[model samples]
Target chain A: EPEVTQTPSHQVTQMGQEVILRCVPISNHLYFYWYRQILGQKVEFLVSFYNNEISEKSEIFDDQFSVERPDGSNFTLKIRSTKLEDSAMYFCASSERDYGYEQYFGPGTRLTVT
Target chain B: AQTVTQSQPEMSVQEAETVTLSCTYDTSESNYYLFWYKQPPSRQMILVIRQEAYKQQNATENRFSVNFQKAAKSFSLKISDSQLGDTAMYFCAFVASNTGNQFYFGTGTSLTVIP
Candidate 1:
């Protein structure tokens, strides 16, 4: 089965620095999403992307966060400036369509902002 | 907004025994989906099973099965013949059927299968 892939299993950045998390979803998948989990906390939705644009986003997805499908395969989440509270495990997920119940999730990238 | 709740923080079962994790959700929409995901120490989210809200019959996957009661907004996962490898944190999730808006996830249940 095809799975979502993410690069840089771990990332460390200084406060106020920019960080871009990369993800390559399944080739034929049509929906992509970004979620974050603070240590020992529930996963929180950040944004969902489809048809080359954002479909929906949560309050946590403020101006500081931006998502773009720079290429046909690469989905990137850029954080304009990092904060201490921004540290968490970021996950990338994809599904064949917007209505599917199953979404393949990639091994999360742990971001540590100091 | 939909909210999934996993009231059990931790559970344990002996090897070869059966274990069930409880999950309850609040959603006004009748059409939706429920899922159970397993996350081990690696932190890789693995889909264990899924249940479509429209289906009345329960969903079963190998040793993993779900007791889905749509009217009560309850979905529970049962693991039979539990093994040491079955130890992990299980999360119950909810997603609307019409859109890829967001997934509402429960806090999580940590299960330990002891030999």
Candidate 2:
């Protein structure tokens, strides 16, 4: 089965530094999303993208966060400046259609800010 | 806004036994999807099963099955013939059909299958 793939399974960056987490969603998927989970916490929604534009976002997806579909398959989340609280497991997910709410999640990228 | 709730924080079952993880959600949308995802030690979120809100009959996949009660807003997962590999944190998620598929997940229930 085709699955979402994320680069840099783990990322370590200095506080205040910019970092970008890259993901390659399944080729035929039309909707993409980003979510994060703090240690032992519930996964929180960050943002959703369709047609190369954001559809909805959460409060946590503030000024520092931005998502881009640089190419047909690549969907990336960029953090302008890393904060200690930004350290968490970031997951990229995709679905074949906006109506098929069943999203397939990637293995996830662990972002650690020092 | 929708909220998913998994009241059980932790649960355990003996190997080869059965276990049930509870989940409930508050949503006004009539058309939606509910899912149970398992996060193993690798922390990879794996889809265990899914249930459509409109379906009256429950959904079953192998040893995994769901008991979905639309009127009660309840969706629970039952794992039969549980094995050690079933140990993981299970999360209940909800997504509206028309929206962009942004999920609202529950706090999660840590399930351990002891041998």
Candidate 3:
């Protein structure tokens, strides 16, 4: 079965540096999303992207966070400046339709900021 | 806003025994979707089962089944004849049909199936 895939399974960056987490969603998927989980916390929604624009975002998705589908296949989340709290497992998910469909998740990218 | 809650922080089941994980949600929307996801030690999020709020019949996938109580706003997962491999962290999630499809996940329940 086709699955969502993310790059840089593990990323380490300086506290003030910028970081980009990339994902390649299923080819036919129309909606994409980004979520994060602190080491022992529940997964939190970051943002949702569709039609090259942000459809929805959570309070945690502040100015520092941005998502882009630069190409037909690549969707990326960029943190303008990483904070220690930003260190978590970032996951990318996609669904074929907008409603009632299950979102398929990627293995996730572990971001570590020191 | 939608919220999912899994009250059990941890649970254990003996191999070949049956186990049930409880979940509850707060949502006003009449139409929505509930999901159960499994994350093993590998940390990959896997979809274990799903239930549509409009459906009265429960959803089952082999040994994995759900007890969905729409009126009570409860969705629970039951694992029958549990195996050692069933050890993992399980999360309950919700998504409203009219919303932007953002998933609301619970804190998760850590289940260990003992051999």
Q: Report the lDDT tens digits of candidate 2 across residue range A18-109.
A: 99999999999898999999998889999999998999999999999999999787999999999999999999999887764578899999
Off by over 4 Å in 1: B97-99
For model 3, which pairs clash? none
Q: What is the lDDT of residue A43 in candidate 3?
A: 97
lDDT (10s digit) by residue, model 3, range A1-114: 898999899999999999999999999999999999999898998999989999999999999999999989999999999999999999999989986688989999999999
Error of 3 at B70 (Å): 1.7
Q: In candidate 2, what are the lDDT values of residues B1-115, reduced to their tens digit?
A: 7889999999999999999999999988899989999989875688899888788999999999998989999999999999999999999998886554679899999999999
What is the lDDT, from 0 to 100, of the residue A66 in candidate 2?
Answer: 98
- Clash count in backbone of candidate 2: 0
Task: Give the TM-score comparing model 2 with the true structure, all chains together.
Answer: 0.93
For model 1, what is the error of residue A8's alpha carbon versus the real structure, in angstroms, after optimal superposition? 1.2
DockQ of the candidate models in sequence: 0.71, 0.70, 0.75
Predicted complex 3: DockQ: 0.75
Candidate 3 lDDT at B34 equals 94
TM-score of chain A, all candidates = 0.97, 0.97, 0.98
User: Candidate 3's C-alpha lDDT?
Assistant: 0.94
